[model samples]
Target: MQSKLLAPYEIREMTFKNRVVMSPMCMYAVEKKDGIVTDFHFTHYGSRAVGQVGLIMLEATAVLPEGRISEQDLGIWSDDQIAGLKKLVAHLHKSGAKVGIQLAHAGRKAQVPGPIYSATKLAFSEKYQTPEALTIPQIETVVSAFQKAVKRAEAAGFDVIEIHAAHGYLVNQFLSPLVNRREDQYGGPIGNRYQFLNEIIEAVRSEWTKPLFVRISAEDYAQEGVHLEDYLMMSRWLRDQGVDLIDVSTGGVIPLEAYDVYPGYQVQYADRIRKKVGIATGAVGMITTGNQAEEILRNERADLVFIGRELLRDPYWVKTSAKLLNAEDQLEVPTPYQRGWR
Candidate 1:
């Protein structure tokens, strides 16, 4: 049987060689705390490209210094950072892989040495700092930061750009009713809460015409927390605003002691959003095997399968998957590795 998992997928003008996407995971590898790409990044991501992964979505890179989840997070807040990223993208492209970046802000979750900001003054937990609530003007500044980050990402030649609106980050904070307690235009009703992301999307669209993606936590796992119903509507809004895809992830909107965890756990949310909202979605979370990934694509559950820990455990996961699915003919093993694959 032809392998849908190994099939080419396209968005806008960029075409992925296969359906595998390297899910964005923070490496926290910037040695100088200057938020620039380093040798570690090159070595780490290069292996995945060499392994023939179709689209390599980079870790959450901060859009502002204070927005960093940690001081070591990569940054695109400055024009100075472009050269390093450009080289990285070129390196990946040389290996016949498309490159993407996640533009992010840590919000109240930021652990750096500065005053953190969020939609409210609440800390994530007792161990975290109480963030100062962002004033209306301050909110606009953060939006501008995301917009500027897009220009830098475009300069770096990224084939795709994903807004980091999930995992209890800055954008997620605004989206979650559990966190955003303000009574202003930026808060309250779901549409008002969505206003922040809407503006950021508009700003990014002005500078970027490439395929854009928005990552969202589809289930908050807390009562009255942002749920699937909320996301279904917001996802529609995202699609209407020209977002090419929704990267569906769950939890991290609020701290959770424990939750369900099994293979393909998050696929249902991706499936629901894709069917109900009529938009492309990427399924993530615990989807660790080739057969499982194939099932998702074959059943039309999600357009792409984002491999996280599995890819980290094996850089050549695509090759392993090809073998498992007996679809080695679909993969173009690098010339040097041709004998091994055969």
Candidate 2:
């Protein structure tokens, strides 16, 4: 009656209560000028923690002001934002769930009326200007920004810090052939494309003493985008550099024109990457069932499965899923709701 997915697991100095983690979904709630964490963020994340998730990952929190996905995306550009974030982290930790922040940079996707990206000079079908390519000095600044964010995240009491290196954001753009047309050290070969992520990982690790996660797309899901072979190579490099988990998600390079994305379609990539890199991983995308999740864990396909939209739809989905699979003892929901348990 018990499912392994509802069981506890350990990764890099911390033990999660179970395998259920809240995926970082953008709320776009932060205002333009102020980068402070609002009460809205506290409530949004705290509720899920109270609902008994194993880990709670905050949305793509920008490392710099211009790196925001949109003007509303959270940022840790200044030390001032730490206090507000601490208040929320305290709530999650007190509720017996661990918390992490997905540190990100939108890169070429910066500055939009909304969250958007255009890496190359050629837009999909519209006229657009190419972004002012980041100079070596600017790149260094960003690396420092990541380090500063990690320091703040630790100060705010996060249990883990995941570098948002995938999904066609800044780091992904540098790695994708479709976006990066640079003739410099950051572009060209797979090694150079991987250099940026490695540098960020090295810098972030210096300040972060906890588990460091790097989320990556197994494939850009485009024949022309980053291929699986190169993705695997990059993932291996990350493992060598000391990443705790390779959170696997795909298809943010351009768009998927011919992807066969059934439920749990991306799980195979997590399986492949883990076997190849010999590193722990978190599987995501279209994973909705407890049975399916347990199968991923049972087969050793992934170390963890992050539930996104499903968690949004049902905050207490974990308890319901545990019982449906007859694994109720695996998790402890609020005692006040004890009568509701079957």
Candidate 3:
């Protein structure tokens, strides 16, 4: 049965069936009204639940209306949306998977007319318009939105709550000097720049009792964005503040080759963040094989691994991966479905 050590583990009060996680991917099927998730969300997340991944982080859900990446993005700013998200958590739990929600704000990335949003703006191009910078009150509102959303997630029965501080989103924007040129308290050197994230984490930490996770861009890939060294400094602070894990994923801070990135091109960030922070880390990006995943775990580079596009390609990738890892017997089959794998 492969190493049982890799089978199930616990942090805070939630236990996952394995180290593999379903990295959040947008279905772009969401239908929201004044910032709320609709029936489509339940069906979409519910199906992912049945796929048997150890942990599932919902996509980048906006915390406010103006913060939304697009018209169809899921949101968590109201009670109606909370009800639907709760239903998702219940369904996923019954399906035998722990659930997580990724709370995000698109910052200058907001209000894109399509299903996807990007950080900063393309004002220099004839095709795009630069966004209005958020005011102090607006920043405070976003902070509350995240706190409220996280509380809603707990009420909705989510086992984990991952703060989306990566991908050049709101928090990412603040962390990056390139995008955030504000002269106020939220900009400047590392300490001042991290104020936004620190406040959000502190607020969420005060209100949330679950295993708090943070997804971060180890390097913004540009000299102006948050560099790897800054992450080392910031990650230590995150650990001190009671963050359980750092979801180490890169890019989205600056545009780079998305399709051409080689396997584990970004894994180095994961390794460094883990060592620098001394916290449990989740390595994600270009990871595609059982041995590769196993090697990461064996070398202690990361405590967990998240598989994105790969899982979308094979819902039962876990079963196949177990076979490749020679741990087939650990498969937790439902009695009715045992015969298939047998």
Ranking by TM-score: 1, 2, 3
Task: Please provide, for model 1 over 35-147, each residue's C-alpha lDDT reduced to its tens digit, 9 standing for 90 to 100.
Answer: 99999999999999999999999999999999999998999999999999999999999999999999999999999997999999989998889999999899989999998
For candidate 2, what's the RMSD? Answer: 2.2
Point out the higher-scoring one by lDDT: 1 or 3.
1
Best-fitting candidate, measured by lDDT? 1
Per-residue lDDT of candidate 3, residues 14-40 (tens digit) = 789888888987666665445555677
- Where's the lowest-lDDT run of ten residues in candidate 2? 120-129
Q: Judging by lDDT, tell me the better candidate of 1 and 2.
A: 1
Give TM-scores for every candidate, taking all chains together and pairing residue i with residue i: 0.99, 0.94, 0.92
Model 1, residue 291: C-alpha shift (Å):
0.3
Clashing pairs in 2: none
Candidate 2 lDDT, tens digit per residue, 21-58? 89999988885556778778878887887788999999
For each of the candidates, the C-alpha root-mean-square deviation to the true structure, in angstroms, is: 0.7, 2.2, 2.8
